[model samples]
Target: MDNIRHRHITSFQSGYDPVLEPIVFDEKRKTKKPFRISSIKLKNTLAPALATIRNFYNKYYNIIHPLSFTFLSFLTRFYLISLSDVVMWDESHFGKFASHYLNRVFYFDVHPPLGKMMVALAGLLAGYDGSFNFESGTRYPEDLNYTFMRMFMASFGVLMVPLAYFTSIELGFSKHAVILVTLMVLFDTAYLCISRFILLDAMLLFFTFMTIFCMTKFHNQKCDPFSANWWRWLIMTGISIGCVSSVKWIGLFTTALVGLYTIEDLWNKLGDLSIPKIDYLKHWVARIICLIVLPILIYIGCFAIHFAILTHSGPGDSQMSSLFQAGLIGNDFAENPLELAYGSRITLKNTGFGGGLLHSHVEEYPGGSGQQQVTCYHHEDINNDWIVLKPREIEIYDNETDVDVEFVNNGDTIRLLHLGTERNLHSHEVPAPLTRAHWEVSCYGNDTNGDEKDYWVIEAVDDIYKKTNRIRSLSTSIRFRHKVLGCYLRAANIGLPDWGFRQVEVTCDKRNNPKDIFTHWNIERHWNSRLPPGGKANYKSKFLRDFWNLNVAMYNANNALVADPDGFDILTSKPRQWPILEVGLRMCNWASDLIKFYLLGNPAVWWSGTVSLIMFILTLFCYLVRRQRQYNDFSPVQWTYFLYVGRICLIGWLLHYLPFYIMGRVTYLHHYFPALYFSILMAGFLMDHFTASCSLKTKNIIFSIHYALIITIFWYFKDTAYGVYSPNIELRGKKWLNTWDIVD
Candidate 1:
């Protein structure tokens, strides 16, 4: 059968010719038989029949050419369906920027504008209102509008399916290999979820794939490496790489890998056994020009375009200068002495005090009889060995009463519950019975009681009306105690019974009152809380410190009682053009900007990481064990797999783990997607090897099982096992074991 197939294929070497032969097949044997024909009959009947059959087969299957496989793979994978019910968290932020861009607002996003720009284009086409604000807007009733944005992102994500397909095809992947890779990407929940959002990961992956595709094309072509036309492809490669970088800096790794691959290709082409000194010098210069100079020029050219558009200035205008200027003039008040003296700086110390300058000295009078003048301080004592600066609080209680309260430490779960009851309660219809209450609470560290805790208190109060007596009380209060310090109160009150009324006026004692100390109360709804006052409610007659100053009259024995509990008082602090809170917010926005690389997900744990690590080690062992295998005898796909896997290990170690350990930054995940891509590629090569050198069906079953497992693992854990949102939630409860819980 094999011999007959070979002969049949060989007969068409000069192009398909059906004349002068009659093709025959043995029905019983299920194989092609020897062909025999008269010349006249072959020309008239056999020739046309064979040609018609060939044309029909090619047209029906659409497999007449190799590129048809890529087209078909793309078509099948481009279903562009929405993934989950809720938009993933990060998509909301990008959707806002895209909406702003469509409204012609200047949006200085931490990420490049391309992804959001694309989303905005989709929104515009879908007739979305330009005034819509994602942060404040309701998602319902406008579900289709939001879906439009997601659909746009998902479509771009599906593009990766074809991108990988064509990329594999260009690299000489088998038809099965191409289909498998495309399906792998399609079925990956992580990939699909990310694609269905207005995030830059899909865009970054798309451009990186394009860069790889262009490089593969260049490598396959025979040309003068130094020729202008030949170098055009190299320039295109560099530009594509730059586009990836523009989306996310992590794309630089892909660029570097491609650059190294190009240099290796050039070195192979040289084939120099031993060259004279002068010829070696000449070759060296040309290599440097092709590898270094040209790539740099192309990279800079691409960056120049981005710079001009983003900065409103030309290149060489000082990249560091703009960042510094933005830090100084754009947002940081500490940089300006005048602003520091009179401006407001929000600190962890002054959470409750108004967040504006001139808060501390606003109430100063000639004598001590005036409203106690609020004072500000630059530094405060860090209590309990924790780095948080202690804030001051003042309380005037008519009397103390037993109360039950709930506390939360790291925003994970409950820690402790204190139980109590009220006296002289009559009816059995009381809102809360005079029994010990069981409350769920969470605690962080200790204060003076050796159980330093942060929590919200819950209580039920009874009321009497003229016509009828009813039992009702406000549910919770924010509470804390440390050393000689104690603070507890309803953070914000909802409507509750007070004697004969449905509302009550809650006020705090007057402290060192400063001039320009503006007070206003804000009632906000908790989106995720489960109790009453958990949803929408209102606050009445609650004093709000609009601003607080920490520098006016540093916390001392005399003014300590008047200080705000949360430390730095933004209300008493003088107003500044730029404040510290804004700076921190900007930094957060900047750091969070790294989600574009898709690699910014969580580090693989004991299972996924360990399995990949073992596979990598085994691949290394095999390569070392089979060192006798010549380069040519090994398929380029196999060789590439080895190179790719080694690259993955090297890059993953440097990019994902090292920064986290050394710099205290976990930005490495931004570039980790390449590791996954290369791992799958290695698996493909391994399957190919087993099929070619061993049993085909056995290898197929094994690979199919392995692929199924990979998919299952990713699917099961994709929600909580990876990405910025995942590990954070899982580790939220394990705060004792994680020092990195400060992210919230």
Candidate 2:
């Protein structure tokens, strides 16, 4: 009866008439089964699509992970082969300074010793094993190893990749984002180039990143702002910033930015206090002391070390007393008095300001119009525009040694002029052949009107003999034209009638107008009034004079020469110190270089690694430290992700400006890169937040697509090795040998 009743209930529960049949209970057999059967539902309805997606992701992920990271990192480095071989113009200058330090010479470099010191350290560790044997007339150090020093920088470059990856992870980026950011840094060409070279820029960047990381971490960690530990970190940050500043003054801008950011953060915290204004002010004051005061102290402290070591005068003492006496006033309590008293004169021309130093000078040539009594003041007070070789000029010539020279020949007398252009000669037109009484001249044109043209003339006079009945006069005129591309000079000759005297005049006109009154003769040609029956005339200009003028103009055009009327006094002039100038110059170069890398080089990967690493350390430290109090204050994951993205943007922007920095000192790109990258990161974070509020399916799809794109793009570029060129194999061997010798 129960079974029948159950069967009736089951029949009612079942739907359609055909499917409504109830199952009978097999009581005797102790088993029960359904009367109707149906196919099982599949776990994944879109299995085929899912399988395809999975396979795609698997392939992409496999290409970029583990071995891919190593391969890509190395490939990026390899592409910088030319960078190692070329030895940029600036590197040579730095090498000279390093050599000076090694030889214990009294040298004065505008930049602090930290960067050069590192180079010296590299040299000491890896330089040749032999010594200078004056008696034997041989240098004991037969091998001048450079590979180890280069490798040191290269290692720094490679380390940035891992650092960036960890930083992204720490910043709370999703696994996919972390991977994306890491790959971006690993493949950056600019970073690879910088790291492979023996320059302070890489060091400055490393320290800058470090300072940023430490400061961000401190802010995130909501510890007692006045605590010793907090102060310690602040001090460390200050020291690092100072170290960067020591290398280049441009680092000061970053320092200032960080300082302001800290103050603002503190100000906001104080504003939120509910306590009495005075009490809050007191707390704020304490915060300032810890954050601001401590940092300043640390900076000064680091500087003090350089001051002492570089200024020391006696044997076994590295005090830079001469620098102190030469106007590095204000000393810490620990400074040595004797060292200060016997200090060396710190002149702008050279740190060793004694007699025989090569002070800059200007040699005036005939300006445009060739005869305008235009006075080149040669005064120290001339502004940069009028000064011709001002600070900007110094920046231009700071690293240039080779320059372009153009020569042209007119049929008659040869005129030579020197034209200076930043363009490499290797790409431009070569010199043409000069034959038979031809003249060549090179000149500089300051304007299209030729108002400020300096011309150099080289003339070749031909020997002529007349027969019994005929007489003739011959003359040559040399003309020089200056243009933005280069200077052009041409020489032409005119014949005088038989039995008559001829006069030739070579004039330089300030105004392009050949008929202008200002145009006066620089070289005048005069012949005897009458010609004899069988007389002969001869004239010629030698190669020495022709080559000399070309060389001079080349130097002048490139701004290699410096002129000072009042001796070295102008060097100490405001904003004119070599150190200050060097800092500004290097900073500008760094900014420009970053810009170029961002646009024309590898945008995705350039400098991203170092930046990512720095941000990761900072974000991680902040998350871990602030976990207790700020557990619910802000989402750790969100903040971390924001920082990770921010790191990518910051590095990307910096790398983009690199080329500009190398070519010029000032540019619009410098200001834009930082702003653009920051905005993108902020916007992306906001989007992420908004997307999280949508349905799970929507979120999953969006995330999957994002992941898929990043993975695919990274894989494609990684395999293609866009920026990875041939490795500087020579540099490797050189650096390795140097390193081994130094260590040994």
Candidate 3:
């Protein structure tokens, strides 16, 4: 097949161009001829019947192509979609989020809300009661229904195949190229595996594919400016971008592609000779409204819905501010307000790197300071609450608020009286458990009567220079500057073992060092009379402010996660290894070995796609340097449009990829699936373009064989992705690469 020769030069754009009538040899016939796709007889003798047969396939391919795409996509993605009843792999993380959504509990995720919200809705519709914990390794509860959730995402995953078909069509690929991409996605085991689980990849891939499809369709509609379908496609493109953005920040790559394309379109319109300069405003206004303004509004709306639904506090509260928690229902300070006084009970929240409430329990971390562990807790436990007292007081309560209230002020040496343990928040010269360079913070047995080392100067972090600084409620972030240790209080993001209840470690960071963010503390739930009193609902009054604050907080937390000792995720994969299908993840195991789902892609498709990418680059270089000039008259208009579509695909791939190489956060192989859509389509275009001289019979046979082989690869790796119990062996004895790690 690789040795198939180019036929004689007889037709350029089907004989319209006479420039490239140069004679070439047909190695099969040893006769001179031009490049053509028909049978050998057509070169010597023009036959009407042969021409009709070739034209029939081209004309009817549009109708028949979908049948093939649907068969493969539906059969694989839908087949045993619920093969694994248990939540597998990263399902623990996303499934837990869905459960939180079902319970109307406010929580946070690194991703935007739409995808998980859809999963929660799917579970709810499927009769799930929002009761299961979805903890890792736990069997799915008897009454809980997860089939619908898996099926919903699987169906979304299947749509990606058809969307790829249309996207390839818009890129001017031949029917063979379109079918290749469709089958590539449909039979790829990774998609089948990830999509059938309670995962976010399905919604992400679907929206991303549709975004490119809508973009191409919109670009094609340029001839009819502002026409109904043109506007519809344009709006749909923006909506698709918004939808994907709501799934993950990876969607930003798609957003960037659209922005670039819109700019290019506007540039072309500005330079067009036919369109008057005054009328160019239409293009500018339309692009801005649909591409920029619409996407921004939709993105904000997604977060708004996310915030609106999660009204009650849940696991994610630990990462938020004390004032932010005040807005959530069931939080104590929401109704049972506290006050500011020398003897008032209080809880001080650390606003530093590891944001958590300063907490202590009855136990000590192993091999660390003998004092009780001082850690950070996400929730407001009784252990987290503390009493405020002067350095030498007896830790006695003074409840009379009518008299002149003695407010703890700056420069006043004080100790944090642990309300539950009667211990004070004390720091000594001993090193911290995690960040050993820092001093240890723990609960010492004595509070009001504690020694000088327990004394700390509590000043507002933002107002530390002001001599009159005092602890403020609902308005200030504070810093605990140790008097004796000469260090500022800080929290290490890392957690101790079960000995410390797996809570964040609180320590003393040196004051002179600049990385002092972890030392800033805020009186999150403090009760005080420094200002006017307000209702608990006042937390909702600062919605927009809280939104920005929460976004920044979440961003920093996720970004800094890698720096945490225990934060590195097991499933993390480097960006470079994704496209080659270099590794596989074992997703599930059973007590009885009934089913085991492994996440891996089809080696043939992935491996070929990798090689095809290399080939496409070479072809592109050849086109620019040689082929474009050699065939300058080869359907000039059509070739220009085809290259434009191909360029968009290339850009889309780069947008979704390349960014991963630079991101600091943990990523997985599934993140590259969006980019794979473009890589496969681009390769398909070059394959068909280069093989245009081959007989249709040969091309069809090659594609059919390629399609069947991938399906066979799917069958061999079926147990790996489908979670069926089967003996482990390489399928077809064709394990071309050891990296596939195909168990069965």
Question: Please, what is the whole-model Cα lDDT of each candidate in the order they appear?
Answer: 0.39, 0.37, 0.75
- Report the C-alpha lDDT of model 2 over 1-744, residue by residue, as the tens digit: 356323443444655453334465677887875554332335455677889988887888644564567666656654433332333424565655556556654344445556777776776787733232122111123365556666665555565555455444344454545555555455433344455556665666666555555555555455465466666666666666766665654456556656666665657666676656776676567556655676556545544544444432222111121122222222221221111000111111111111011111122213222221111111122110111111111222211233331112322211111112211111012221221122212222332223222322222231122222111112122222432213333211121122112111112222344432112111211111121111121222233332232223222322322334336421112211111111111111122122111111132222232333345556557766877565743566656545544544454434333333343222321222222222233323333444656777786676566546544544543311222232333213222223111011
lDDT of 3 by residue, 1-744 (tens): 444444333355565544443345667888866544354555556567778888997899887778777777878787887666766877788888888988889887777788999989888888887888888777787787777778887888888888988888887788788878888888888888888888898899899888989998998898998899999999999899989887877888888988888888888887898997666888888888888889878888877888888989787876776676777887665543333467666777776533778888898767766878889887758888887777774444455545566766666677788888898888888889878888888888675356788778875555321224555554565677898878888875676677788788788887555346677776766654442444565443256655665676667666754534557544667888887887776676633355766678888777877777777677667767766478663477866765676677677787888988887777777878888877777767767776788999998887888879888888877776776565454243534566544444
TM-score per candidate: 0.45, 0.42, 0.78
lDDT score, candidate 1? 0.39
Lowest lDDT 10-residue stretch of candidate 1: 418-427
Top model by TM-score, which number?
3
Clash counts per candidate, in order, are: 65, 72, 15
RMSD after Cα superposition, model 2: 24.1
**Residue 715 in model 2: lDDT:** 50
Superposed on all Cα atoms, the candidates' RMSDs to the truth, in angstroms, are: 21.8, 24.1, 12.2
